[model samples]
Target: MSMIFSWRRRRAGRGRAGKDEFPDMELSIPTHFRCPISLDLMKDPVTMCTGITYDRGSIEKWINAGNNTCPVTNQVLRSFDQIPNHAIRKMIQDWCVENKSYGIERIPTPRIPITPCDVSEICSRIEAAAQRQDAKKCLDLLKKMKNLAKESERNKRCIVQNGAGCALAACFELFASFSIEEYTDFLKEILSALTWTFPLGDKGKSKLGSAISLRCIALFLKGDDLSSRKHAVLVLKELISEDQDFVNSLMEIEGIVEALFQIVKVPICPTATKASLVVLYRMTLSENSEMITLKFVDMGLIPCILEILVDGDKSICEKALGILDSISSRDQGREGMYENALTMPLLIKKILRVSDMATRFVVSILWKLCMGENENAVVEAMQLGAFEKLLVVLQVGCGERTKSKVTELLKLMNLYKDELDCFASSARFKFLKRPN
Candidate 1:
């Protein structure tokens, strides 16, 4: 019941406010059609406990302005609750319709505010369906709940306060042990609803039992349906991002980490790829689990990550660089870095072509490889045209930190003129002189 009414002029048999049409005639509004407070047509008319009816917006403004008295009667209000004057509202709509030639549009039906009782009743039905293993009934109720929550933030809070989160979690657990082949479609609908309601920061995610969630969601990631797997990863991403305990306990869940790697490695979709990459990045960064880091390199993720860095989306490239930088800082990870023949050339190509943060990461990965306290490392980079890229950056402007790295890398590799002469002899751009 919160529609704004304003006068518009008629032009070309259409309702539009224009210079010539508005002055064609001055239409008068009935006094009863106007709010005593604002003199505007009452869109959402309501009666105060003082028996005075006013437009809801006007009365709310007057009350909010610190006057507890009725604007018309000037009598003190014992209670401030405003009851909707539906009869008056219908009259207003009828009048607007009857005045269609005057260009007044019909007001839309106002949505009744969802109460806590509504949330509780829905939650109860969902919980009962879960207990009975009625997948169809549970899906219907959860879909309704998700729709109601999407109506407004107030509805979302009411749903959570009335136990929607816990109810969804319980349903997830009840359906956990079932095979995907048997309950694939039902599980997809259920997980979608769970993910929808999961971001409320309610204690339900934790109270729903982490072990149960981790196991069930991990299994969902292996399902045949693509959307369910994607939704499962996203839900896991949001759920685990806040809890460090879950990050450490990840190793305990057999295949949870593998599922994430699979999704990141061969994602069913771009969203899934990005979400999985982000989750992996956050988990590895949050906890410096050396075992996890080594396992990442051991699984041949470095090569896969290098491919992603070469061809992924701009946002995904930045995240892939961040992940590679983290994992490549170790001895084993360093080995994995140069093990892929395309790594250095791809890294060189991206030097100045990406965002500043990505450029910095590319340089960091190179530094880790070249400065692994080995002379061959620098020579390897020089052979791959990294030397020329470094010289170009030195000639042009670059960040101070990146320039320092380039200078240090050059200093460590600086050697006899004959080393350059020898390198120049075999260079593809043999006539291309190095920048002074």
Candidate 2:
């Protein structure tokens, strides 16, 4: 109906022709052909040797306007030397008139409906059912409300921003706290629904999924309920073990690891770095330690770990070192593992350039890490020429307390033990000996 009015308007405009002449305008089509670009019967048909036919007039106009390519693949098309035959033009026009919606552009999707559910009302009913101590009634109501919400969403009529909030409230109303069995049931359902929200090819969706999953995992790990924690672990294991690229790609997401790191990085957080360190610790425990090592190594996990260490997030820094310890311990006889130490020189140089006190402190822990079979690492440090720089930092020149700490570290390594006896004859040592 709208199309009929639009066509009439277009005809009226064409009748009021310009003072200058215009090219003959006609729609055309080759029999049994359609434009892949427009997904419509072809008009102003231009033939290719490959037997592909196109609408030349539209193609030319698009090219002159600087498009210069097929509408589908953007492949360049040569000039249209042969105009389409009149018979073809008539066929396309007849078809367009018969199917008035042909060649019509599609409208964009409507916005998601913002019909907010009355959270309090839902909560009241759930609470009332729970007060009656009717477990079945409470569960049934939860299931019913969830289904209703889903239906409303499918119909584009409701917005429930936090699904977990609703589920949590319902669980609280029922038991004042849910049991592991009950909590697991709710989490499994919520996670399943949440997973469905991911859109194909959406980087934002990928990030959102990872974030929500992380949050759920954190809450589960924190909750005293054993079943919830077990379920959370199960979910995390599934996520980490997924062969699908979509989920695994979350590792490449920026701030993802950092976000998880921040929570576990704090020394004050109970079980701080516990869950995270356990994850790293377990990876090295796999029967195929080499596979996990190589995988993390490729993801630049070592650099990230080193960065965390340099951040002086003490627990996480120590945790990362522990992870390194476990992996390196396994690679003792393995030729492939020693090469990882090669990164130490680069890490040391970067640490030396940083001005943070916490960073230097954490980096100093390298003394502890590099204690045994670290001749290669010591050589690398020396090659980077950090020993003299470190010794200089150890003297009275560095920050007063930090200098003491540095000197202590140097002593721990026996770095200047031989030189100290030789230093007794030096002019600087004599001057120091005479000083107050």
> Per-residue alpha-carbon lDDT of model 2 for 305-326, expressed as tens digits?
5555555444554556556655
Residue 339 lDDT, candidate 1, scale 0-100: 75
lDDT (10s digit) by residue, model 1, range 156-238: 76676677767787777677655545776776777777665654354566744467667767777876667889988877766
Off by over 4 Å in 1: 1-107, 115-117, 128-137, 150-163, 177-185, 200-202, 207-209, 282-295, 351-353, 374-436
Tell me how far the alpha carbon of residue 354 in candidate 2 is from the true structure, in angstroms, after superposition.
Answer: 11
Error of 2 at 215 (Å): 18
Compute the lDDT for candidate 1.
Answer: 0.76
lDDT values, one for every candidate: 0.76, 0.47
